[model samples]
Target: MTGVVRLRAVDIEDLRVVSALLQDAIIPIADMAFLPDAQQFVMLASRFQWEGRAPEDGPTPDDGAEAATRINCAVHFSGVTAVRRRGVDLRQRGAFLSLLALEPSEGALLLRLSGGADIRLEGGAIECRLSDRGDPWPVPARPDHGLD
Candidate 1:
């Protein structure tokens, strides 16, 4: 995938793919929106390029021969009947959060973020799309979870 990344998710399995790609993505508070009239929830994230990473490269960029890359991506979920935010301060426009996962719980889609923050969407069905908005750039380091 040399060009822009585009993905669609209509089910849990497909969402797993999108979730994996967006893991560790950085999202600014000001970049999120919930359009009630449109029944949509959208957010822009600076996502780490995890697709091409080699298994032998280990975790950090320092352990690999290639530098880590990041790109801006826009994600949207349609058919969102309701949205609930927790542990997120919408007033903190400058604050950012790291994406942890996207999972289904009790028929709702949950966007797990760092610092125990979360945004949950409830609706009839899950329809999510992610598209890269700009060129990818090399990042100095990869996100470390201390799992090693």
Candidate 2:
């Protein structure tokens, strides 16, 4: 298909799309130790928290509190674009995305680029390259205990 493919920064609204793509792209390879439901829940929680969504009360401890914290520190850029970079490994199952946040006179923006051909934990860091379309924005990092 031929069309306008513009590259810009990321934003808050893009979180859902990025999260869904990451989850859909990763599930096939995630370790069988985790039930499908658990995997989906984790993915949704991560995406929702990142997108500033209120947490739902669950049987787990402090779930609501943690979700609130994540929502508070969330950040995003304005423009966004994506392209297939390389082949992904489907053997490993985990969601990994590189996000960049920026702020300009217009508004805040967030960019989320998905990697891994299938489902695998690929080591990478968030890259921020200033573009004419957006300015860099800082997102406060929230404290995560690595627990549910």
Candidate 3:
């Protein structure tokens, strides 16, 4: 059966889990794309504002400093909050997975196991799949720009 899941804001706690998941699911796929010293990867899943940053003023100097010190640019497997759906298997449960950051224009995003792993972006209507057979995750195509 089909279901709906919504992704909310992500926090430090969530980042912990996302980090592990990213290591498990993304590292082998990314291979040398990431640096060995890099502890995290920045991710832009949807539009979300930093707690202290205002819509008008942007991020503070402290934000930048903190991010830089903590390898903030990287996106880790933030965390998972589940919504059980009857008849769905253990691997197919609905979840609101967290990401580090995303452009404001992209709305909400959901992560679920559909065959392998899938990232479903709301407004963009984009679905990215990571092959279970150990293939790399498929990057979503960017929307048209100047041509449009």
How close is each model in CA RMSD to the real structure?
Answer: 2.5, 16.2, 16.4
Q: Measured by C-alpha RMSD in angstroms, how accurate is candidate 1?
A: 2.5
Report the CA-based lDDT of candidate 2 relative to the real structure.
0.27
- The positional error of residue 74 in candidate 1, measured at the CA in angstroms, is 0.6
Task: Assess each prediction's global lDDT (C-alpha) against the native.
Answer: 0.89, 0.27, 0.27
TM-scores for every candidate against the unseen true structure: 0.91, 0.20, 0.17
lDDT of candidate 1 over 1-148, digit per residue (tens): 3468899999889999999999999999999999999999999999988775454647633465567889999999998989998999899999998999998877789999988989999998869999999789988888889988
- Ranking 1 against 2 by TM-score, winner: 1
- The C-alpha stretches of model 1 lying farther than 4 A from their native spots are 53-63
TM-score, cand. 3 vs. native: 0.17
lDDT string for model 3 (65-94, tens) is 222111112233222122122222334334
Candidate 2 Cα outliers beyond 4 Å, as residue runs:
1-45, 48-68, 71-88, 101-140, 143-148
Between candidates 2 and 3, the one scoring higher on lDDT is: 3
lDDT of 2 by residue, 17-50 (tens): 4443222121222322212332211121122123
Clashes counted in candidate 1 amount to: 0
lDDT order, best first, reads 1, 3, 2
Q: What is the lDDT of candidate 3?
A: 0.27
Worst 10 residues of 2 by lDDT: 69-78
